[model samples]
Target: MGNIKKKKMIFLIMLFIAIFMIILAIISPLLISHDPLVTDFENVLQKPCSEYPFGTDQVGRCIYSRVIYGARVSLGTTFLLLSIVFISGLIIGTIAGMSGGIIDTIIMRIADAVLSFPDIVFAIAIVGILGPGMKNTLLALSVIWWTKYARLTRVLVMAVKDKEYIHAATMIGASNIKIITHYIFPNIISPLIVQLALDIGGMMLALAGLSFLGLGVQPPTPEWGNMLNEGRSYIQTAPWLLIYPGAAIFIVVAVFNTLGDSVRNLLDPKHI
Candidate 1:
C-alpha cells in the first residue's frame, strides 16, 4: 500500500510537469516578450534583467524569448517524428507479423539492416546526405527511429496472434485487416504506449544532440539544441545563455522519462 501510494504520487507529479511543458510549448509565442531572432549588438551578453528575464545571447538575441520559442520547435519536431514512426511501424510490423514466411523474413531483414547501424551515426549520415535543416533532420531521425517501434510491434503481434480470441476471430472468417486492427492491435497498445512515452524523451535528447552538433535546426532558429550550440562558446562569459536552454531540455526530457517509467510500471503485470 505504501509503495502504491508513492507510485501514484510520483505519477501525478510527473504528469503535471509533462502537461505544463506541453502547455508552455503551445502558448510560448504569446508569452515571449521580444523577437527571438532580433539582435541588439550593443547590448550583447547582458545579464538577466527585467527587460530580458533570461539574459541576452552573444548577438543580443533575447535568451528568454528564444528559449520559449525553442520549446515549440523541440516539441513540434518530436511529435512529428513520433507520428511518422508510429504509423509506419504499426503498419509494417502488423503486416509482417500477420503474414509469416517470405514477407516476415523480408521485413525483419530490412529492419535488422537499419538497426545494425548506431542510431546517431545513421541519423548523421542521412542528415549529411540530405543536407542539414529541420526537415532533413526529422526525416533522418524518422528513418532510423522507426526500426525500434517496428521490431517491438512485430514481436508483440507475433506473441498475441496465436491467442484464443485471435484464433476464434480467424475461425469466424474475419478478414486479416479486421483481425489485426480490432483484435491484435488493441492488445498490444499498453506496451506500445509505454514505448511511445519513452521514445518521445529519447527523441528529444537525440534532436537536441543533433542540433548541438549543427546537424539539426540551422542558425537563427530558436531551437534549444541550436541555442546550446551557439551558447557553448560563451559558456564562461554568459553562463545563463547555456543554463536556460540546457535546463529546458533537461526538464522536458526528464519529465517524459519519469512519466514513461511510471506508466510502464503501472501497466506491467509483473510489477502489480
Candidate 2:
C-alpha cells in the first residue's frame, strides 16, 4: 500500500540521519574546529558567522564544537546504558523464567518494587543521595532500567519454553544453555531489537534530563543537556546557544523514534 511505502521511505531517510549522527559522534574530535573546552572571552556571545557556524556561547566556547563533542558523550552514554540494562535484564529474566518457582517470584517482586516509582523521580533520588555525578547517574539508571528488559525477556522465554520445537530439542539431549542461545534467542530477538530501538531515544532523553537538572555530565564537558543548562540564561540575547543543542537532541531523538517505529512495524506479526 501507499502508506507502507511512505513509512519505509521515512524509515530509510531517518536511518541515514542516524548513521550520519553516529559517524559524527565517532569522529567528533577530528571534526571540531575549535577546542570545545577552551574559552575565548574576547569573542563571547558572538552570533553565527563565517568563523563559527553555530556561534559562540556566553563564555565564548564554540557552540558548534561543543555540540559536536556533546554528541560523543550523549551517544556513548546511551549505548553503554542500553548494553548494561539489556545484558543484566536478559540474564536475570532468563534465569527466572527457566527456573520458575520461588526464584521467579522474588525477582519479579523486586522488579515490581522498582517499577512502582516514577523512573525520573527515583533516578533523581538515587543521584542526589550518591551526590550529583555522571557515574552515579549511569549506575542509577542502569539499576532501574534493567527491570524492563528482565520482565520482557522473562515473558518471551516463557512463551517459547514449552513450544514443541523446544521440547524436541530437550528430548534430543541438547543442553539448556545451547537451547537458549540457539533457539530461544533467535525466536525472541525480533522483539528485543524493537525494544532496543525504542529505548535508544528514551535513554538519550533520560541522560539529557538528568544533566539539565545538574545531576548528569557536569559543565565544560560538552554534553547537550549541560549545554542547554548553560544556554538557558541567554535565551533572549543568544538563542543560538539553546537552539543548536536543542535541535541536535530533537533531531537525534526523532531519528531514533522513527527507527523504532519502523522496526516495530516490520516485526509486528499483523503487519507481516
Candidate 3:
C-alpha cells in the first residue's frame, strides 16, 4: 500500500515536470532574456554572469536565451513529430491488424525493411534527398518512425482481437466500431501512451543530430543541436556554450524517460 502511494506520488511529480517543460516550450519566446538570434559582437563568448546567465556564444547570442528558446525547437518540434507519427501509425497499424493476412504481411515486411537500416543513416539519406529543412526532417522521420508505432499497434490489436471479451461481444452482436471503441481502444491506449513518453528524448536527439550535421534547423536559428555544433569549434576556449545546451538535452531527455517509466509502472497491475 505504501509502495502504491509512493509510485503515484512519483508519477505525479514526473508528470508535472513533463507538463512544465511543454508549457515552457510553448511560451519560450516571452521567457528569453535576449533575442536568441541577435548576436552581440562585443559580448561574444562571455561566461555565465549577471547579464547573461548561461553566457554568450561566439556570435554574441545569449546562451541562456538560446537554451530557453531551444525548448521550442527541441520539445515543441518533437511534440509535433510525435503527434504526426502517432496518428499515422495508429491508422496504418489498425488497418493492417484488422485486415491481417496479405496486408499484415506486406506492412510488416516494409516495416522490417525500414528497420533494417541504421535509423540515423536512413534519416540522413531521406533528408539529403529532400534537400534539408525542418519540413524534410519531419517528413523523413515521420516516414521512418511511424513504422514502430504501426507495428506495435498491429501486434496489440491482434493480441486483443482473439480475447474472450471480443468473442463475447461478437456473440452478443456488438457492432465492430462499438467493440473497437469500447474494448479494443481502452486496452491498447495505455501502451501507446507509454511508448510516446519514452519516445520524446529519442526524437529530440534525432532532431538535434540532424541540426548538428547541418541538415536540420539551419544556423542563426537557436536550436540546441546546432548550438552544440557551432560551439564545437570553440570547445577549448569556451565550454559553457556546449555544456549548457548539452545539459538541457540530457535533463529533458532524462525527465521524459523517467516519465515513461513512471507511466508504465503505474499502469502495471503488479505495481497497483
Candidate 4:
C-alpha cells in the first residue's frame, strides 16, 4: 500500500511537470520581457544580472527570452511530429494487420528496410537530400518515426485478431474498418499510449540533436537546439549561455521520461 501511494505521488509530480512544460511552451512568447531576436551589441556576453536573468549571448540577444521562446519550437515540434507519426502509423498498421498476407508482408518489409539503418543516420540522409529547414527536418523525422509505431501496432493487431471477440465480430459480418475500430483498437490502445508517452522524450532529443547538427530549426530561431549550437562557441567565455538551454532540454526530457515510466507502471496488468 505504501509503495502504491509513493508511486502515485511520483506519477502526479511528473505529470504536473509535463503539463507545465506544455503550457509554458504555448505561452512562452508572452512571458518574455525582451525580444528574443533583438540584439544589443553593448550588452554582448553579459553575465546573469537583474536586467538579464539568463544573461546575453555573443550577439547580445536575451538568453532568457530565447530559452522561453524556444520552448515553443522544441515542444511544439515534438507534439506535431508525434501526432503525425501516431496517426499515420495507426492507419497503416491497422490496414496491414487487418489485411495480412501479401499486404502485411510488403508493409513489414518496407518498415524493416527503413529500420535497418540507424535512425539518426537515416534522418541525416533525408535532411541532407531535402536540405535544412524545420519542414524538411519534420518530414525527415516523420518518415522514419512512423515505422516503429506501425510495427508495434501490426504485432498487437496480429496477436489479438484471432481472439474470440474479433472472430465473433467478423462472424457477425462486421466490416474490416468496423472490426478494427470497435474491437481491435481498444485492446491495443493501452500499450500504444505507453509507447507514445515514452517516445515524446526521444522525439525531443532527436529534434534537438538535429538542430544541434545545423539541420533543424536554423539560426536566430530561438530553438533550444539552435541556441545550444550558437552558444557552443562561448563555452569558455560565457558558460551560462550553454547552461540555460541545455538545462531546459535536460529537464524537459527527464520529466517526460519519468512520466512515461510512471504511466507504464500504472498501466501494467501485473501491478494491478
Model 4 root-mean-square deviation: 1.2
User: What are the clashing pairs of model 2?
Assistant: none
What TM-score does candidate 4 get on C-alpha atoms? 0.96
By lDDT, is 1 or 4 better?
A: 4
Ranking according to TM-score, highest score first? 4, 1, 2, 3
- Taking every candidate in turn, the Cα RMSD to the unseen true structure, in Å, is 1.2, 1.4, 1.7, 1.2
Q: What local lDDT does model 4 show for residue 150?
A: 96
- Candidate 1's residue-wise lDDT over 91-209, tens digit each? 88888888879999999999999989999999999999989998999899888878888888989999999999999999999998899889998899998888898788899999999
Model 4 residue 204 CA deviation (Å) reads 0.6
Best candidate according to lDDT = 2
The C-alpha local distance difference test score for the whole of candidate 4 amounts to 0.92
**Ten consecutive residues with minimal summed lDDT in candidate 3?**
263-272
Instruction: Look at candidate 3 and give me any clashing residue pairs.
Output: none
For model 4, name the residue pairs that clash: none
Clashes counted in candidate 4 amount to 0
What TM-score does candidate 1 reach? 0.96
Model 3 local distance difference test score? 0.91
Clashes of 2: 0
TM-score (all chains, Cα) for each model: 0.96, 0.96, 0.93, 0.96
Runs with alpha carbons beyond 4 Å of true place in candidate 1: none
34, model 4: CA deviation in Å? Answer: 0.1
